[model samples]
Target: MTNPVKGPTGRVPGWVKVVGSVVLLLAVLFAGLRLSVLPGLKDLFGTETRDRSGPALLESIQDISRYEAASGNFQVVVDLEKDAKFLPDAVRGSRTLYVGAGTVDAYVDLGALDGDDVRVDDDRTSATLRLPHARLGTPALDPERSYAVSKQRGLLDRLGDLFSDNPHSEQAVQKLAVRHIGDAAKESGLTGRAESNTTEMLENLLRSLGFKEVRVTYGD
Candidate 1:
């Protein structure tokens, strides 16, 4: 006869066998659930699948039309210190000083190119492309780089700040920063550089497509 299984108390281990079986069953269930949900887990994690290559794979020319050629970045700093007096000659006033930094992007817009704007030689050896003027996009204020340096309020002005929910002085400073940065970008010749860069880009692209010569020009 086979020897009987002896537990710690010298009897058959009925409870231990049941606990082991339960643990094994739970593990198998967990593995099965994991395998079933594996496919959709990527979506839950915000991972996307797509083709990032150029639009040359499109079937027709209409699908691959507009291109934004960003060519220049302008960095600007603006400083302002102003005192606003409520009364004509009163000494009480609010004084604020702020410094802001931002970047402006210059790019060439090519969305309106028509057949008349592009001409390719019959032999595909040369091409001419007329593009629109280079324009400055909106200035982006870098919040992390911009701040109010100092703020001073007179006796009367300090009382107003205690109950005011809006930060009027800070807002004014930000507006001034944007206006000055825009003006600086225009005076810096960044737009001209953008135009040159965009021309060079198109020339290189055309050359890749077997073009021996490429002429790019800007139109009003």
Candidate 2:
């Protein structure tokens, strides 16, 4: 061999340079995997979600005959707890916090109208209408916007969930939410607003039909 080829002082050895290059390449690969630059590798470790639900079935359809005059949007937080009679919270109790959103419609039932509900003068220049009071419809919850905020369960409750088909039942909370929304709608003057709107609508309609005067009244 020719003289052994000594390099300059402080220069790295060929083997050390080779090792550093290998380490740098490995670091780049790891970074690429973390950043999802390689689709094949990313799919290997990624989670796939699937919707296994069936198609929606057609239910009975009924014709609506009520005028939707006003709607109230409501939100409520429900805190519900259940406990065993003789067990401590840690042993057999559960608590949940849910946020519910819904809407309540106030409507006037034009379907309930009768001959006596409307009156016209001989010349048809004046008219009178007696209509039923506005009523509130059922509270409709917005499932897309409502969700459980937090839940805490005891050891036994947690264990029972492992074998239960419906681990976390929300029926009670949902019912409570509907009830609360209904109550709020009752106190929100929504029916009054509906009545006012219906009166205005009838007045405008009758006026356009050649009636110069219109009197609207709400009763049974």
Error of 2 at 117 (Å): 0.8
Clashing pairs for model 2 are none
**lDDT (Cα) of model 2:** 0.92
Q: What tens digits encode model 1's per-residue C-alpha lDDT throughout 1-220?
A: 4446665567768886898899999999997678667997645655578988876675655542334455334444444444554562134665566777888778776768889999998999989988888888788778887877677666666677778887454777788888888888888887788888888888888889899999998878
Q: How accurate is candidate 1 locally (lDDT)?
A: 0.74
In model 1, state the lDDT of residue 95. Answer: 56
TM-score of each: 0.63, 0.77
lDDT of 2 by residue, 1-220 (tens): 3334334655567987788899999999888767698567777777889999999998999999999999999999999999999899999999989999999999999998888998999999999999999999999999998999999999999999999999878888899999999999999999999999999999999999999999999999
Sliding window of 10 residues with minimal summed lDDT for model 2? 1-10
What lDDT score belongs to each candidate, Candidate 1 first?
0.74, 0.92
- Candidate with top TM-score is 2
